[model samples]
Target chain A: MKRGSLYTLAYAAVLGLVCALTLSAVDGFTATRKAANARAEEVRNILTVLGVPVDADAAPQELLRVFEDNVTEEERGTRTFYSYEHSAKGFLRAVRFGGPGLWGRVEGFLCFEEDMRTISAVTFYRQEETPGLGGEISSSAFTDQFEGLSAVGPDGSPGIRVVGDGADDINEVDAISGATMTSDKVEDMLNRTLEEMIGRDGFDG
Target chain B: MARADKQACATCGKGVCDGKGVVTFKDGVWHINPVAVQVLGICSALAVTNRLENSLVMGAALIFVTVGSNLFVSLLRNITPRRIRMIAEVAIIATFVIVFDQVLKAYYWEMSKQLGPYVGLIITNCIVMGRAEAFALSNRPMVSMVDGLANGLGYAAVLAIIGFFRELIGTGGLFGHQLLSEAWYTPNQLAVLAPGAFIALGFLIAIFNAISGANREEGSQR
Candidate 1:
């Protein structure tokens, strides 16, 4: 049947209203759980990078509890540091860092050992890089290279390098083979964060 | 209608006078399978099939969206104005997709992250919209739902097959389990990348066509 303009407009308005209501109901139902999941993920990353042993299967509440009991969140100016005292590694500090990536923002935590200059671990908890190429930044093959490496360069500058070739320097790590732009962006972000971290008043490198 | 169509109609329940449920199911699942037969919705098929779990979840999401949208569209089919029907169908489809995405994010946070925007992209997946337009608009709600379910399953089945091979060959594992020992079998890294999806899908389509072609010839002879 042919429908007039008035009927079509009314039908469209009604359909739009119905969809909006349905979406609003679903959003309301999931808002709490989504927030908890996001919080738990952030806490999980912070704990993992700080070398604090939390169960991989821990629930959001459990992760939050572990994070609260073992870790201290200290705010220094604009930066927030998550510090943990491990039974084995002694003391560790992790800070959140992020920068514009090739596709979107890439964010992660940079953890440091007791000496403040030596790296303990790194985790790219949030990134939107290409799945197999730039996305490898989150994989252990890439992030594991940060362990025991220095955040300071050979010239005493507070920076790290993601080199394409073999990393021979104390602060350099190998870049992902086919992801030069991502690697460079990662390097730039790490250096920017590192500069603020080590060059600041509290840190003595 | 033909005598065979009349006979089929007699067997159907009320409001399903055409007895298209079984036919729709058969068409969606196998005869005109969404992914394998029609080659529709290949983007998610390729993007998520690198892992078995990812493929399954993605498939489930599609199934939910398609079925829900089809049911809603069919229910409103008669009253839906011809001019705004497409817009109405889209609104219903997007609602279901967002609902699935939200629930997935809340309960299965890890899988939600793995699937990423692909789950949200279900709104644009042609299988859901195609069924809503081609079948649901003209069909009863029950048959429309069956069509949705069948197409979703057909798509999911193809995805599972592709995922199974890609994971096993690419990483020498199924669902992240080590089936092929590193000492004996070296994983083909290509199978884990995007190109692997195209290769796997191409092979699957070829195999599907060969079998179906042979079946058609046999039926013709009979």
Candidate 2:
């Protein structure tokens, strides 16, 4: 065999073999941790945006306290909330949140009570916005405003739609001040999520 | 001295035809500058430049990717054929990108998420390929090694300067913390956007070109 031919064959095989091995190893190393981190971040986002008291890097327990209503996912699309059992106690409901974004999309979940009225926990799935300005929608000041508010709209519909408030009232969100589009998008997204999850009729509660 | 010269002659071609370091230097400084010259890897610079702290982390990642790929390509240059060099180059680059990506996740998860797709995009960065083909392929290992270092350092300096301005103006902060006093003027939101990267880079390139051009003229006259 020619020297060049032998070198080329061996090198290609070795490179290919090494790449395959590295790909598997990288997947193994990152996939599990990445998934867990993603879940935790989602939980944190929901908690933060809903005005729930959970740190951005808070553990699952911090979120669990508020999200005590474990609503398991319905197989036949019966219930909107995902329910799960707690420490040998009762169940809890994790309400799903979704909305259009200025650029792409934003989604999240907030677990609440059986009445589907009071806030439980909040998290965002996706948000493509300017980091500090629009992205601050994830801040507690914004979500904390949602806490203790009626889950139904002004029309008494399920899932309240956020409208811009002229005053800096604590109960009403101020519409992200300069970021009107982002604010509106999130508001509409919340309204749409409520409409889809619940119903056109007012909250049965 | 006598034995060294004899060994050089008998070798397949490392010492005989290797580039005398100039090609690698040019690759680092002129042809494939990480910022202005080649315009490669600008996404990370834009995304992370919001803070000097994040930019430093990003720059370090860039350096590691460039150096890791450069070393591997040079080491395997003996076996890499001319026909499929590009294939080998991309594979080597991707391998290093994964390594850096994993490292970032393990330690700096927040910064890693902020950096997002830039780490994965390192595989497509032209600086790595440009240096690998132009210098690493034609040189000894040490020369190629130095080439990667110089490029990385140069790239980092550019990132730091941009980050300095963007962070100060955009957020009145450094590394995501407030640096300016409360009395400072309002932050310039424009500097934080993607378009700001283009504007800042344009001015930087023009200034860089002007300064280098003046130096050349002075040297010639002298």
Candidate 3:
């Protein structure tokens, strides 16, 4: 049977309305849980960077509790710092850093040991680089290289280097092969954050 | 004709167990598998098959979307206007896809991050739309659901196989567990790249075609 134009229009309207309602209901139902999960993920990243012990399988609430009990959050000069007092390592500080990546914004936490120049850990919790290439920045193989590296160059510049070739400098780490653009962007962003951190006084204490 | 049988089955309500249902199941899972045979929805198959976990989750997502959309489409098949049917189908399919995506983001945040936009891209996967247009529009709701499940399984099975080989060869592991010792086996980097998906899928389709071709020959002779 042929459908009249009126019937077609009505059918379209009804279907569109139903679909909209369904999506809205689903979005409403999941909004709270999704927010909690996102918050938990951020907390997990902060805790991991600050050298605080975190359960790998901790729930959202559990992770928040750990963050509260161990890490203290303070805002200083537009940058929020997460500080943890480690018995062996002394005071550790972690600050959020973000900038333009190859595809989108690359964001992560950069932590420092008590000395303020010694790297503690780096975690690229958010990035949109090419998988298997630039995407490796988030992988432990890449991030682990930052551990024990100095934020200051041998020349006393307040930045680290992401070298394309083998890293031979005290402040340089090997950039991911075949991801030159992403490497350069990450280098710029890290340096930008490092420069700002170093220029500020009283941070070392 | 198949069309006649479909109309009869739609009215009979016994289509699920009748010979038609068995044929539909076989056709979907093996004879005309979505990925292996028809080659529909290969985009997600390639993107997610790099890891077994991602592939399985993607497959589950497709299964959920297809089954849900097919049931709704079949139920409204009669009243749905032909001119607006495609739009209606898309609206229905998109709803299911978003629901799955939202739930994944809420409950399985890590996996959701791994999948990224691929879960949202399920809205454009032709397999879901094709099944709705071709089978659900004609068959009974129950039979259409069976068809959806079968097709989903077909897609999922192919993805799992590809994922298994890719992860094993690429990373010397399965589901992130190290299976091959680094001392003995060096991971083939190519297997983890985009090209690796093409090579694995190509081999899978060839093997499937060869076996099905042989089966057809034996059946004709019998």
Candidate 4:
């Protein structure tokens, strides 16, 4: 073997070994922490959507505690949703959802009122839209508008719409001014997910 | 070998305290500052400086990667072949970047989300490669490490200043805290966006150049 080629091979081998070792070590060490964080975030999101008063800076333990005390996971047939009993109302349901966003998948939890028809809140957990534009889908200014809006009409049709701001429709929420595509996609996501939920045996009233 | 000789040695020690690596420290910290003096690694400055928290984290990440890659590059300087040294340097730089990325994702999950694609983009950051090529490739490991750290700080300092103004004015807050009274002051919405970053960075760069220029003149006088 040529001397330089031999050096190159040695360099490549050592570099590969070192890189693999470092990456694997980090991955192993962080795997549990990452999982715990994801779980805590999910718990927090569920609580937020359910209107279960969670401090934004609450510890993970506190979040888990709140989630356990207030929320219950209900399974019917092959579908599952988080349920919380309201004092005045019957029960609220929340489902985790994900769909195509402008840049990537947008994922969040959508909560419903006791009737399972009115959207109580919507919280996006992950989105890849533009930060100031399409990214506003995650913003409360946009998501908050979905509150008290009907997810389904009187005839059981999906009536949710992402309309321009200030249009007179009870079923429509304002689209983010510059994020028309993201708003439309979010509307599509909600309608599609709600339709699927309605088709399931447990979701039908 | 008497009392006078001992006293003389003590004074000399104090006078020459800058010793071996002090010049490297000085170079990294101020005179040859990576961001201010060399004008490298401005992408993260623009992207992360919208918020102080993001800038601080980005700075620390840059420091970790830069110092790590510099040390490794300097260590392997002798053995690395001329033809493929860039490739070797990139491998080392990328390994550190990924390690930093994984650590952030694991520990500071929210921050990882906020930073989004910037952490992974560290491998492409010009400052890391710039330091490795210019200093680490020729220097000893210790010096290179110092250079790396100094450059990271320089970059971080600039980002922090930019973030301070952007967050304070754009959002009427600091680190998302509502410092400005809402009823009195309204936020400049433009400050939170990309074009705002460009304008803020431009003025900051101008101020930095003026200060650095003055420092240069003072150093020349000395």
Candidate 5:
């Protein structure tokens, strides 16, 4: 029985430890900043929904400042301000809107001011839509139209319509040229969210 | 005679390239195809084919990882013990995967986001390991390098074709810009979805299989 020495195991253990430490350090070095960058990216996306110009390259501090000045948060049901520095505000201006998608949950954040009739910014947290088509909803072209779009209907209804071109309503953003289903789904989700915030729901999940 | 060296050994499937420049055109055309022909390295193939830009990034990333992994594994084959070879191969491959991942993040941050987790998933791709053990372990570094390049090209060829269709049809655009006359048909948004990837992949696989079969028949005639 010509058994090899413990050297092989020693070699493997050392090698494994080195790899683990290196990977962990790489992850650690980036994790906090990535998290903060992600948060900033969210803020920037929210600002885009408000139709404000976003420089993703800007410092997160500057981005946060821009977000603070432009889009104040409102509570879910009460339209209470949720801006961080505003100690008296009751809730965050942004609320999460989500529902089932073709692949998984289609969730986005909607940031608004004290008046919930306008959507200051929108950013989807998760979606598995068709990559080029529904996927492009995440694209600037698609999401950009959402800026300046009204959250409430002209009749002062709490919901918005996903309509084709020619809707005279200020709240209506034209449907994506080919992605009608995904477009409708986002519109429907927002409408349901509005309904929930207005106390129309029997219960909030 | 060549027949004498062909004696069946206990490790029959392990009769890898014997470092004698035994690489051939068949390796390129079919035997080691990164996709349907070899049925290897497909997870990333499906995920990153949505946009041409992302697909190209994924392709380049894989090429770098595969070739680097192959070179290192082949170079280290002699010193490695037979028992722990798998671990050795993985360590070598993972090293390259990390470097590839970091380079993408540093240089192509936007494409990296669009690709999502698929960049990391390259580590798990069977073809990279498959080539490492099957060819690289036994072949010289230069030929092993070619094997890696060929396999990557095979995969990229399929991916680019798929990307072209997925981008053009799915978004009514190509490479992130509009190209189609919207009047013909609204973007077949369905094509950009995951199911579209599967459908397109299946057709492309069929087309390749057919061409390969025809080529085989022609060779027999010749």
Candidate 6:
């Protein structure tokens, strides 16, 4: 009813309207580009793990080109995975898999050698872990250790182990020092998620 | 030199060419630099300074938010009710922050992802709020915009220097390229973590203080 209160309410309403409009316009303009970049990044990550050696500075179109030319999607029962084969090199298979991370779904691709028992590379495309701590799991420092490591043990058990301090086994990678939960989650995912995928449809190496 | 006249210029009307506005604008950025001097938003400074790409992107985002919010706040300063001014300022700042976030997500998705929550956390950065209240609310639009930009650069400068050291020494790389040969050099892992950031920042602040102090002596004479 008061004059000043009416002005304040009108002011708030107008400000809110303008903000909504601005944000919507920005969102509209950016949505497609964001999706495209995300797709390119996914392709790039897969290409990297496949030993295809994607240049980080390569254009999005170039990355897509490589992906289209080199990668083929295959189905095993209900599961789908990517396989890369070259005339010089034998065959490399990659699976895009993840489970719950410390904060949210951590999604990434893991590529294996033709033998299917050794991990050739592991790359995380998305993770919601604490920065500089658990988040380091995606860094090459951590993922590089997975390369050339056995994902399955000699006696047919979960072979990948995450050591909290230091690791001395071929199948072990040192965990991030300050990120115990995230490291543990990664260890669990490696052991469980990979096995679940393998059992779900009996993936043929 | 004129004390009485200086006080009068402080209350000059908007759209006026008063030296007070200019001086305060400069002061907000320099003599009272947000990061080095005032130490307002050090959280992002440390977190993002581990790499040059991240620090640059974060700095640009902060500049965009600060300048955008300052301009908007100055434009609406006359109409914004006193009782709810803080709320209005926050809403305006958040809007710009989201715009920055969306732009990064669209164009620089990798950098955007690396920066992560820090981009969204700009709304909570004290420097933005500090400038909005201390400078923008009571100044002309142009002055407020300049003030915001200068302060953003001040913060950026510190972040970049800290980033340079962290990236160079911690990773033996600059912006992810290995600068030091592995055979001849090894990285200081401590510089890759938060404690390293604190140590780097402390030394930087001390160095900046000494340099600025010397500069002030010459500045006063001129």
DockQ of each: 0.81, 0.39, 0.79, 0.55, 0.16, 0.61
- TM-score of chain B in each prediction: 0.89, 0.82, 0.90, 0.86, 0.84, 0.86
- Report the TM-score of candidate 3, chain B only: 0.90
Clashes of each: 0, 22, 0, 0, 5, 0
Candidates in order have lDDT scores of 0.90, 0.68, 0.91, 0.84, 0.71, 0.84
Residue pairs that clash (backbone atoms under 3 angstroms), model 4: none
**Residue B149 displacement (Å), model 5:** 2.3
Candidates 3 and 5, the one with greater DockQ = 3
Model 5: DockQ against the native?
0.16
Q: Put down candidate 2 lDDT per residue, A10-68, tens digits, no spaces.
A: 87888889987987788787776666666666555544434444455555555555555
Q: Model 3: per-residue lDDT, tens digit, B24-49?
A: 88999998899888889999999999
TM-score of chain B of 4: 0.86
**Residue B174 lDDT, candidate 6, scale 0-100:** 96
Q: Write down the DockQ of candidate 1.
A: 0.81
CAPRI quality of model 5: incorrect
Q: What tens digits encode model 1's per-residue C-alpha lDDT throughout A78-117? A: 8899999978777899999999999999999999987789
- Where does model 1 exceed 4 Å of error? B1-17, B214-222
Q: What TM-score would every model get versus the actual structure?
A: 0.92, 0.75, 0.90, 0.88, 0.66, 0.83
- Give candidate 3 regions above 4 Å deviation: A165-168, A201-205, B1-19, B214-222
Model 1 chain B poorest ten-residue lDDT run: B213-222
Model 4, span A1-205: residue lDDT tens: 1347778888888887898898999999999888888899889888888888788899788999999998999876555689998665558899888899998999999888877778888999888898888888878888878788888765668658888867466677778888889988998988888887765555556
RMSD in Å for model 3: 3.4
RMSD of each: 3.6, 5.9, 3.4, 5.9, 8.0, 5.3
Higher-TM-score candidate of 2 and 6: 6
Which lDDT tens digits does candidate 1 get at residues B86-120?
Answer: 88988999999999999999999999998989998
Report the lDDT of model 2 for residue A31.
Answer: 76
Q: Which model is ahead, 1 or 5, in terms of TM-score?
A: 1
By DockQ, the candidates rank as 1, 3, 6, 4, 2, 5
Cα error, residue A181 of model 1, in Å, equals 2.1
**Regarding TM-score, does 1 or 4 come out ahead?**
1
lDDT computed for candidate 2: 0.68
